[model samples]
Target: MDQGIVKLLPAVRGIAREAGEVILRYYTDTVTAHVKADGSPVTAADNAAEAVILPALHHLTPDIPVISEEQHAAGKSPPGDHGTYWLVDPLDGTKGFIEHTGEFTVNIGLIKDGVPVLGVMYLPVDGDTYAAAGPGTAVYGARARHDVPISCRVVPADGLVVLSSRRHGDRERLDKFLEGKLVKEHRHSSSALKFCLIARGEVDIYPRFGPTCEWDTAAGHAILLAAGGSIETPDGQSLAYGKPRYLNGEFIAYGRK
Candidate 1:
């Protein structure tokens, strides 16, 4: 691991935890939810969490620009070619959060050269924090004070399992994809947790055929890759970060070495 990234881990973890707390406060309250111009949902918790996380990240590395979901929805873009930047989804799985499912997450990722170099996904309800830098990844359940190494399971074909999205699901395509394959079917999960499930070796694949932004998947992708897994477009190209529009194409996250 790069020494600089190692140095950055503490601050990243702190910001993620703080942001998670901010989201949780609203999670337990009666909050208002609205749709953005793009027709995606947003809530007060999302803004509150971003307010806490963005500034903390800037303070940690003043030179690096940040691109956050709330900021982008407000038409704010990262100002310069930083070579390295922070990608944030302060509150992911807002629909689930609004429904009081406690499955939302605060995602923070460091991207360099169009790829995530470090990432953190924090679940406030459970106090589980998943982090990765380079090729090292771990899951820390904050309340439990336990750290578990995270890695994808290399299951044989017979044991293959796929995790899909519950909210933004595509049933027809998914059924077609799995028609001939011998695998177990599981219900979809929300947010980056789906990717984390694959990273932790609980699922073999996650194929998302619906729309998603860069911030939505970058952190999870980084952690998954660090955990000896890979995510790619359906065409088999590795998903790249820092695209011109910040929108991601449909992709498949695979649990494999």
Candidate 2:
């Protein structure tokens, strides 16, 4: 890990947690949901959380620019520079959050040269924090006494367990894929949490054919990769960051090393 990034972990974690706290404040209290032009829900929590997170990221790494979900929805995009930058989904799983499922997450990732090198994903409901700075090592939560080391499974066998979205399940395709194979399914509301489950060796795979943006997966991708898992295109190509359109194609996260 770079010394700078190592030094930055606390700041990033603090920002994520604080933003999560802010989001939780307005989660269920606000009745009406704000929708974007595309008809996706955008609550006060999303904008409020981003307001807290983006400034903190800028203060932590003044030179690196931030690309956030709220900003992107507002018609902003990352620069064409090939240097490092921050990717943030200040309130992931907005629908879940709005529904008061308590499965939303605050994500922050450091991407360099088209790949993530450091990332943090924080779940406010449980106060769980997952972080990784590089390959082969991931530390979750605070470092003093509660932090736990996490890694992915090395070899997945038959009866493999997979995590699927609770709100976005596609029964037809999932049933077709699981047929003739021993499989167990676990459902979760947040994308980042699903990735954390795979990173901690609790799930074998997560496949998504639905639409998602770069910010939605960047943090989890970094943590999963650091824990020896991989996020790749359906055809097995590695997932790349900083695309012009910001929309991600179909991808699968494999648990095996």
Candidate 3:
């Protein structure tokens, strides 16, 4: 199964990039956002990207069930076997995308037994991609170059480099969480880019206090895991997937853990 997953990674990356391309077709300063029942924003870019990804993913692996954001939001999720499935967020950071922040991404992750075994995250604006298939298979790429191996770096003696949500986060809670830690630098990013930054050794930790769905983190979690990092609950358990309604609680992502 690992071999099969490895073989399918390139195809998954291709699908993510293609979805990103579709998303870019809807990118503009005046992009409109519609409010979902849950009060979160959605856009045509999100739907268009999902439209590209779902069919491509189905064609690539017919047996694997897909749980995509838009599809699920529309009450059209598939029943999975619980052992293997696809989790996709066609457009993460929709607010940023609508506001011209250019921080959104196309995320695809393969989960097996509640763990993400494969992930592909593509930034449509820059054509940057981060991918992984199990451990020791993490890589980063862009239009100029592809598949450059990446890994997490040990925290420097000075302090930890941290990433926080740009659009939203529990600032008071995050401050409390970092009270005793030595933070050398603190930065803000939208969506799963924080995970990619840690995977590429640009950052050290991401302490998220607010709620997020499974699709929001799965792909980034897989890439982080493949890069020798870890994401754990507040009490220090490994973060598992396939939760009811795909909701996630607080978790901290770390590099070189």
Candidate 4:
């Protein structure tokens, strides 16, 4: 990444935090959820969060076009013709948020030359923010916690700590994938936050067989990479971004360095 682009990450993280606050604002109330054309849920939180993220992102990097969920819900298209852009999931885990699980998050990712180079994931309920850009990664926990640099730990000799999607895990596929692995523990989770967990080495791996959009994983993907971890296919290829329609296929996240 360019030094200038790396410098923009702090501002981007701040914007994601602001958008997370918007989510919290709606989270505290009885917000309604609506179904989009694809049968996915959307809520006031998603829109409000995007309203905060989109403009601030463009302000931070005027040349980058932002591709966000709500914007596409409004019929906007991705400017794939551009060499660099942003992928924003103003509110990730809408179902979790709607169910009041406190698992929802705000995701902001910067894509340069078709790869995610910067990412920020903010959890609103507790105001925890995890960010990664150029050469390193960091986390800002809530309650006056000092921002701390973070990295993925090498897998311990004991066993693997596996994380599965709380909302969309394919149990059979996962079982088959882990058939011969020494699994010490497993957790069910929702959203890109799982990627953050792997980034910080709290979890060792995450496998997703379900469908997901680019924005859904881009931010956390960047963070995981910066933490010296990786998100890749079962066959071990790094997930590439800016594909047609911004869709993503099955992939696995690994915490090992």
Best by lDDT: 3
Candidates in descending lDDT order? 3, 1, 4, 2
lDDT of 2 by residue, 14-129 (tens): 89989988987886665468888877888888899999998888887888889988897787755566568899999888887877778889999988888888889998788889
Q: What is the TM-score of candidate 1?
A: 0.95
Candidates' C-alpha lDDT: 0.85, 0.83, 0.92, 0.85
Q: TM per model?
A: 0.95, 0.92, 0.97, 0.95
lDDT of 1 by residue, 1-257 (tens): 77798679878988999988878877665768898888878998899999999889888999889999999888897765656888999999998898888889999988898888888999999888888888865454566687778888887666578898878888899888877777765767888898889888889998899989989988888899899888899888999887776899989999883
Better of 1 and 2 by TM-score: 1
- After superposing candidate 2, which stretches have Cα over 4 Å from the reference? 142-145, 155-158, 185-188
lDDT of 4 at 81: 68
Q: Model 1 misses residue 153 by how many Å?
A: 0.6
User: Model 3's lDDT to the true fold?
Assistant: 0.92
lDDT comparing candidate 4 with the true structure: 0.85
Candidate that would win on TM-score = 3
lDDT of 3 by residue, 26-140 (tens): 8865888899999999999999899989999999999889999999999999864477899999999998888888888999999999999999999999999999998999999
